[model samples]
Target chain A: MNDGLMIEVENLTKRYSGHAAVSNISFTVRRGEIVGLLGPNGAGKSTTMRILACYLPATSGTVRVAGLDVYEHSEEVRRRIGYMPENNPLHYDMRVREYLKFRARLKGLSRRRSRERVDVVMEQCDLTHVSRRIIGQLSKGYRQRVGLADALVHEPELIILDEPTIGLDPHQIRAVRQLIKSLACDHTVLISTHILPEAEMTCNRMVIMYEGSILAADSPDNLQRFMSGHSQILAEIAAPLEELNECWAQMPEVEQFDVSPAEGAYHRCALTPRDGLDLRPRIYELARQRGWLLRELTRNRHSLEDIYVQVTRPEEEEES
Target chain B: MQAYLTLTRRELSGYFLSMTGYIIIAAALFLMGLSFVVLLEKLQLEPTLMPVTELFYITPFFWLILLLSTPVITMRLFALEKFSGTFETLMTAPVSDREVVLAKFTAALVFYMIMWLPLLGCLLIVRHYTNDPSAFDLGAVGSTFLGILLLGCLFLSLGCCASAMTRSQVTAAMISLVFGATLFLVGVLSSQLPLRPSWQTQVLAALSFFEQMHDFARGVIDTRAVVLYLSATLFFLFLTLRIVESRRWK
Candidate 1:
């Protein structure tokens, strides 16, 4: 029924002047899902997020946020979504508490309700320590936190953050990442970032784009599973590797295997799986029967980084 | 209504918090105080000085201070938001652009009024020291301030519209100066035009802010003058709203 979806975008496009900033793209975020919109620069990630936040209108196509059409019911949709734009601009002249209170009011909270929310968000974002500190005088990390607290002061159902951890140090990045992960308990969080590792660490599902188009949208696990060569096995074996290679090549589980003779009557070996099955058991069984001593056996699964690069690779030919 | 008040309060507090507000007020008061001293001394020599009828406080130099002061007070109204990238955050909030435009307009208008507060100090000083008990012309004083406010309303809106046109405060200030000076010159030069008889009414209708202020300083609050200033303010405020909305397209 699409009832559990928090965002539904179809054929959305945004064109500036004669150029299309965001070509036709479509994706969805289910309720309570931590979705990441990941892409390189100029890949329309910000434009798509802005459209979904109701900050910018799409050139064509329909987007619904919280079951409300972004174009026709923008105000209502805005109320439902807390959007932190790229760089997370804030009123630097204001104190953290003052800024949050004002933002709460602007988001349609009454004075008493706004005060309560100011405290709640400050506590949630861990901004209570700097609640009375001037935003301009705070460190960059503190300012980023204030921006996030301001976004959630109204207690929106969905939260959208654009590059939430763009300029943070390693420690601050970790803190912000944990804060985002915690938010998914009550919020449908959509984060847009070119920082691939950040997205992999935080998002449950990813929308990877390249050249103004979505190349893939799936869970991180599913994406890695979808890659044809997802894992590699490495081993060092003794006792005449040529005989073992002949037997391994005939095994059904071994997709391909390479063996190179090494010093002291040993061989370096590597193998890939043909099916989506772990070949460690079969390899061990075959080794026991063949009387070949297995010295080292290790398997490495494909990471999101590999799949991200494999899917969103830039074209060899540049766009004119 | 609460939303409007919240925006207005934020804007007003922004002035008191920023350096531009203090600089504009100081510059305006310095020039105003200079004129107040020079004019008071000059009129005292004539032995026929009245606190109210002395148009020195509301003379050409007064308009000069206004022309110089407007750009500073209103230059950052919208341009700063655009420059700081806060406009996106603000526009995406539940509030409408109309509320934003009005709130800023009201804040600039209020700051403009604050700049004129020093004029009151000058007037009260003139009245207290003068020998004649009937020296103060309340009507002239009231009407002159009214004239100042109406003119301030028009120029501040012009400055606001200029701010909306760009993301640079310096450029916004330049726009305010260009438009403010152009309108002031138009108002002054229209009367000097060698017009045919029928053109007199058209010139008076279109360009008479300078003329209106002259009459008001002499205790004339013409309805025509009031209507022109209010409409010009609304017109520019409306233009600002449109510019803000059009930024989404750009």
Candidate 2:
């Protein structure tokens, strides 16, 4: 059963009163990979993460974590998976250290081990300064850190965080992202977030979900490349439109071209490569040969945001 | 076992950590002290054949404190967790549903017992003043306190059940208060009704909490009353467990 896979979800479909929140989706996370479950609101990312965490039962299909069925071996699975649920609900009455200690014990750590782990997680999450402070009195970022400490106190192998950076400021978000990335050395992380750029930065792979089904699952780079088959080149050259059109026709690498006027008698041209080849060098060389002054020649790359919009736009059309 | 103890300790400390717990204890002790003072005043006016413990247990103030305080004590057992969304974390832990329900029940019962400990101190004050060895009967005091414990077990479980059903502490308290009042009134009113057959009167008397407390104060240990309280407590606790488990299906 040591298949190097930390999570295995098979044809999972979670329905609520005849509505499918997760409709027949499947994906896997390899050990040591920080996989991000990316989707818009109401796209079932939370539902899927909840099932993998064993917090909710799947309506149909099976989910296995660390090679054990989540339903049958729930306690065992729970022992190995640390789940920080959405909004990071915690006891506001208790002090940070006290709450973490209690959670550690509840997660089946021995008293001494719980104490040790509590201190470790406090240091790891940078909550050691506010360890004695009441959670209710702390700020939202500190409270979130306490929640993360609670999850990590048990030393679980797989860490599942649902929107870990949802309400954090930029600095705190960056800090939390670093903490999540640091956890990958000893733990497999599965984080669900709607923040596309955050996933693009932290995840080794992204699982794009839309309307309860996974549209794509790959590295951020691969997703961007696969979603859009061809790359574009933008060129601003001091040349006549007629000559530019003629130059575009001569180059077979340029599939389609659009030209518009720029500043001081300069013309801007947008070119799509037929085989996704680099048209930048070719355009630069062509301008040199034709004695045309090329001011700007740059490749237009697709971001993860663009790919996400492209993947989900078709589903929106079908629904409409 | 460890999870149960940890959860119970948390639940018990939760009461004292908040103002609601301290407020409940203060209000209960104040009512008990007032009831004791009034009872002593009434005793001074005329000597009665009834024992001091019997009179103390039968007061409307005693029932009022019992009925009202049980709901407040158990209302936050489940409702507060649900309100704060911590119930999701609690239920997702590796603990079983039964352990959670039982831990909460045990914590509430312990807090209830602690709230009543002052009543014994009030009785001790009376004994110290009277200076008579036979002035306070140990058997009567023991049985009266036993009756309080048993009734608290049943009523507090009802409160736990109500709390588990909803996320609002006020609604949970109100629901359990209605439950406790209706149960008490049915037994009290049934015993007071006239023109009832002997068999029916006997059954009503058996169900009457006032009658049970009277017997307890007289040192009569009725196994039937004991069974009723214990069984009803378990029944309500079972209902609370089911309510906690219903989240998985819903």
Candidate 3:
């Protein structure tokens, strides 16, 4: 067990009957690291998070949190971790402040300390104004904030959030993303989401899972860089397709070229650059020299979405 | 201990804050009051007659039916958390399964006491009307109250166990009601068996909640009845705790 790591999951597996929901998987989250568990639905992201939070036990292997085995020290692990499920389950009858204070006390805080913690989390989650209102009466956004506040009230070192922004509007999504980013300074966070944009914006590192197995684990930038070599450039020109293809093929930087008809008199072509070469400046110079109109020229940057597809693609496509 | 107290306090506060608690109390009181009026008229008894004692006699019947509604009050105790996603928050806290179950059970018991208060008031009124209220069967009344308390505790535990089995409140209530009714009816049906008087008494006594209540109604304070009620209460509570603990594995 690594003392520096806040969470350590080794060969963790959850099987329902004979079928595995989460196959043998392993990972570690060190203190102050914001890691994303990115996967599509049924990809076992939520199942893995639940095991780490001690809400559910793994069928096989071990999970340790705060240097304690989760199975042997569940109460200790629970005290050291805060978890927010995908549905944000809460008792709607209790007031927001009351609920948070109740949760703080359940985490074994002294009454005075619980109150103080509740106030701090209320402010952090922006739930102070509606602290006296019943949770059921609050809007979806405020209810979500209340859920986050309850999770933070005990000041756990680790926070596991499952699909935190599933139903939120754009503004609410941005707010939650910002809050998650701010939490990374003080707490280790493991957030699960199928939404690529949410993971890209809030997580510093991510693990991509497909069919209950981890396909890759690295920083977002590094994962994108993994798909960098097989790049394609798109260019639109208001010239004859035959002429554009001939010129694109002549350039030494352009390793391969394909031209297709565009709307009206324009033509579209894909230019594959040779090793360690950028063809944009060369293409611009060629357009200037030949008086050929260059309508558009842009390099295709690999996004998290592209990498998700690449990592999860079939074995045949993955090898190719 | 502190976590148990905190959770119990929250549950008790929830009962007072919501209409479910008030509604159950009001309904029980209204039925008790209506029955007192009809029973008084039929017996042609004075207002000072031991109306409260008669009212206590009918409590088990009312409780058997009213306790069915108690599940609606407590069905959301743990099930609501599971349904609304708040269970994830509770399960991750440092509290033990025993603490959580006991807290919720105690809260429901307290609410049951509050519901019984109005009937206690009716007893006080009976005391005021009688010339020799001290002659009244205070022993019987005390025993009856004990029976009621034990029965309430038993039902609450049963409800909690039923609620823990599912996330749906309606399903919890239905299952609890079915089980409670079966227990109540078994007692009634066993009494009609054409067997030796001693054998009949033994079997009917085992199944009969009313038989258990008879000792209390006579102010006898049967230790055996007390033990039976308590054991039943503990049995259901233990089952509820086990159900909650197993959830972590699933």
Candidate 4:
């Protein structure tokens, strides 16, 4: 019994009609942790989440949710997890409170308990005002909230949301993001999204996937630092292009740099070291020694987008 | 048992709360009332022949309404959930696939029964307006309703099975209509086929819902017809469960 562990997926693979939709991959989400499955469309993020939620069977792997085997004990796992599928499908004819009450009852909550949970979740998801309104009459944001409320009303140990903010407005997106972030203290959340910044801002850790494979998994900060070798330093040098090039070739410390026209007689050069070191100080001193006036020097570290594209692009090409 | 009740209630409400249920009910009552009026005029012409109770089962009107209402009542059972994308929410709700299928099947049956419920009002109107209390056979009425129940179970099960096979309601209705029409037509056309064997006639009699209703209207209960309808209903319901379960793995 791995204490405080919500999910453990090992060598998970899902194939459809001889075509692999989710290749062999392995990852785990600990208790009360907010983990994001970051990938583009058709990257199998939903497949992984579905397998963990016990909505789909893994082609040839094992997924245990809340310490129960997904295949062998799927009912137990399903009881412990709340799954909000993509597009936030809802029963539009049902009212907000009625739908949540039904979902609570369906999840095995007693009538009194279901009522209490429905009230609490309605308040938590900001659905108090529209509790009596039919779901079809509600706006998209409200419907999304209804979906979230439905997932949380069960009070499951783990909540899996697949693109919960797909069709929400900016305000609704922020509200949903804040709602998901607030869930971290009590619930383990596995969120799948293609939006890079949302994952970075909302998730405590990320499992980056591409083309049915997991490329990397780490915190947003650690991912940037882990791929720091790919970082580039930009220096605006006030000198002639040929002089900057000639001086650059003379120094072994400067490995490869691109020179472009800068603002009014200043030439911009981007320098990247082969060894992935902080070349800012060395380049500044070299600039002073070479009699070249430097205007701005900054390091461009990798963001989630850079890391996402960098990790997923090569495999996309290979599959094509 | 609680899970089954919850699902059945949800499904029942899904029909009642939507326009589909109301529209089908209203249409069925109107059509049955029209058929009642036509049967009354026919009785005026031929005074001492058929009982007033025979209008429900002994006429083609009964089979026509069954063929039309069964598909419409069941087309949206799973199709709307698939169209609106609630299959995920409904399927993952900590209930077995069998519970889900049974819930839907039972809900459709209840609504199908509701649609025919207003026809009883027609009988009361006929009793009040016409002085024909002696012409109504109480025993035949009970058996007729029993036959209607069994036949409804069979038709709604086929409709639910067709709806389960697709996400589009139109396609579901079309497939179910085709299946119901084929069965009804085959039963009606059974006599056209030249048959010498007693077993062939028995087989045709078993499949003929029209003849079955006629026998039931006269209070003659055939265990064979009852068994066939019950078994066929169970067979389609089992097929529906398989389809729902196959969706998870496939």
Candidate 5:
């Protein structure tokens, strides 16, 4: 209920018929933060987003937006949050500008204020040129921009976008990512995406969900760090393959190592070190002592995808 | 009030901008004009004879059929939003469910009026061609117009309710038509039963739209009939509002 917390959802659960779509999920989004809800298809991302947007009520839990409970003060919560659904719902028969104007009026803006806000959003979403075009005739990219424009027309405190770049080309995806990044300076945003690279580029923090429960929640860097211990290190050297293998095997800290043929006059070895060990200094000392030519020595950086896989992977694999 | 007015205005304008409105109006006028011609010719009236009185009696039946013909017009009132994903946008807005339902109903009513205007013009033409136009019962004609307005409002409200139940336009239209046809035929179907006269009158009066409409076309503005039409309209409008409000829980 703090002012600094833009959204607070506690023990939220949604049940359809007798089955739970989302069970006991809890998260909070602070003011001016860009958080990503990361999950695959049917991971209850949309259900959670819908609950927070006040479009759907949770079966048993409390959702507070801007310090007001969503169930008791839905109208007030609605006034403070803007939502863009995954499907980009729109009245295709209406012209772009006309639709924005209608949406602005419906959001309770005055005539002059609505007009000004419409113009501002149109420009911000790069929809000014296609303002006169009917929505059905526009391309998918333009339709998405129009949807974003409508969401921002009322100038709410928090904006929730569900798969905003779902059906866009590379260029269009970049454009939307830029627009989302730009929004972070002025408004708090909660974006949901199954695309790991997209989340890495657009969001400041991420919550990974699996089977209707959050598996992990942290910043991108922190998530990578959490998975880095299990990452493999690759070293390419210009020394006798047998000597490199022997040196790596003798190092008790080296848990496992394998040497294979590299491009030319070089041998590539992948090494897994013990947990919490830094193999770079050890490898450097070994290469210097053997007067070996070190062509490539790199610690493979773990990506969001690797972190996601690690967090959601089964306990059997984790033990291995 | 401003939100209501703005939504209503947008809805009203949407009707004229689409081909559905034009097609419905054109078909209604064609049927009404044909019925008017047949009635006048069968009565063996002269070419110059005024048939305004006859027009009023026949127009309601044609309007009734026309009401069923384009039930889809209002069926898409909320169904299209749900189908096309616009309902999410509307629900997230500051406008209440009452405003959305009322705006859609008012838009359908205004379109119905535009459709009826051409028939009114035909009446004026008949008046112009007659030598004794004063003999025409203006009171009956006025009452019938009022009756059609009320009936149109009722049908629109019913269509809104059906639309709110589903996101498919075709399914919404079918539901409304089935319900409307049943309401219209109730009076005729009930008379075949061996019921007492008092009971028959009460049941038929309660069930029949045409019965109430006939009373209006006879130059008698029965307050009971007026109450029936208004009650039906308000009841369906309220039901539509409730259906829309329930979407938040889903």
Candidate 6:
């Protein structure tokens, strides 16, 4: 039976001779969801992706792709999953069109279908311009697209990319990110990257892995909120510390406040809201009522980096 | 089956599209031409009972060409994929490990056979110029080609096994070179050494690739040699398949 789930991994542990690469990790991805396996280097992201793509077998536990057990139905799972491995490895000697067509045919497409998909994927990946050029002669960005085109040529149900944007310039990264975002309409994407901005921008949900185990799994917004109970607000005003303390005490939205002296006459006041409330307007109105010189009034929301760092800090500290 | 054919075509085109394949063919042509001229001179200087095919197949240059070219042809089979990081993409395709190994072996063996095609051309050129109908027997030449094909199968499979074991093409070539040289050396040493036991002599004689080639050159179809080479080829291919599958464990 084809369930709504595209991938189902439970208690998956991949152990090398000396150590485990992925240890008892469990996660799932629904169809048509862009899920990011976010982790740093040596975090077993590639190892997990490899296992899911049927390139590597797990030492223990089970992985199912499209309701088929990966170990037992590897050929079927591989036919359904298009995997662009780390570094986007490709045949350097083959031209783009030739390579994509070869990959399409290898993935079980008919001859005419392979040709049609090669053209379609080449256009989708913006590789139409360099379709005749040798892959070894192409730039890194074009090579990355060619790898992407190869992955997409067969029109697989699931696309797994490991560090798809790595080693690309900002422009290329943005383009690749947009391309990945567009793929979510038709296919389920399970991309792994250490770049927080990439996950924040492209992925609908993220599973943060650290030291071979999943640390957290949620949407970016929920992760930020769950990591810290409430968001903080920063307000710098050229007013006395006692006045700021009295002003903060007056507003119940300001659950906690700390005032530190700045250069000249400005005082930096950090306030944590009691709830997930926008305290910036209230702080601005307070400054106007008190006739205080407001230099800065802004909500200090946690970026994905901050949440990732906070989530991964305990284990990093334990290792140290 | 389609995936296997596609992979085989890709590998065969890889050899031809690059300069390595042409260089190999050119070197084989030169070596074969030189050996032919040397054989002609030796024949002109003295008469012998051996047929032209027997003399041509028994030349040291023939064995040297086979020994050297098979490694170069097969070294890039799996090692280059691993080196370029395409092994993941290749293995992740729907094809099984057996197909992957067999495709590479078949491609290399085909290329090896193509590399020796110049010898037939040399034979034809000699036959045309001399206008001698009995210069080289067609049956002997056919058996000689069959013997070469069998040996090519064994050598290419051994080289494929070596290539599957390592990522470095140079290391793969060296390993297969060692394997091929050891096989040849055992044959040579067995013939040279005076073994007292009759069974030992019979076994070594059966194992000797030189003896096998000599018999085939004389149009003698020895089923023992055919079975031995075929079995060894299968054994090496089985080893290569295991090596390719070992990546799952690694």
**Per-model TM values vs. the true structure:** 0.96, 0.95, 0.87, 0.90, 0.91, 0.94
Cα lDDT tens digits, model 6, B130-207, are: 677666689989999999999899999999999998999999999999999999887787777686678988788777
Best prediction by TM-score: 1
What overall lDDT, based on C-alpha atoms, would model 2 receive against the true structure? 0.89
User: Could you report the DockQ of all the candidates, in the order they appear?
Assistant: 0.61, 0.63, 0.59, 0.56, 0.61, 0.70
Worst 10 residues of 1 chain A by lDDT: A311-320
Native-to-model Cα distance after best TM-score fit, residue A124 in candidate 3, in Å = 1.6
Candidate 2, B220-245: lDDT as tens digits = 78999999999999999999998887
Superior by DockQ: candidate 4 or candidate 5: 5
TM-score of 3: 0.87
Flag regions of model 2 displaced more than 4 Å.
Answer: A239-243, A264-266, A287-292, A314-320, B193-205
What are the per-residue Cα lDDT tens digits for candidate 3 across B202-243? 767676676666556556677776787799899999999999
Worst 10 residues of 4 chain A by lDDT: A246-255
> Which candidate model has the greater DockQ, 1 or 3?
1
Task: Note the chain A TM-score of all models in turn.
Answer: 0.95, 0.95, 0.87, 0.88, 0.92, 0.92
Decoy 4 TM-score against native? 0.90
The CAPRI classification for model 6 reads as medium
- For this target, which candidate reaches the highest DockQ against the unseen true structure? 6
lDDT of 5 by residue, B13-107 (tens): 87777787777777777877776677556545544333355445644456465556547678778888899887887777777789889998998
Deviation from native of the Cα of residue B68 in model 3, angstroms: 3.8
Query: What tens digits encode model 4's per-residue C-alpha lDDT throughout A154-221?
Result: 88899999999997899999999999999999999999999999999999999999889999999999
Q: What CAPRI class is candidate 5?
A: medium
Model 4, span B43-115: residue lDDT tens = 7787655556676565567888899999998898888898988888887778888888898899889888878
Lowest lDDT sum, 10 consecutive residues, model 5 chain B, at B46-55
Q: Model 6 Cα displacement at A172 (Å)?
A: 1.1
- lDDT by residue for model 5 (A170-257), tens: 9999999999999999899999999999999888899998778899988888888777787788999998878888888899988989
What is the C-alpha lDDT profile of model 1 across B84-105, one tens digit per residue?
Answer: 9898888888787789999999
- How big is the positional error of residue A264 in model 6, measured in Å on the Cα after superposition? 9.8
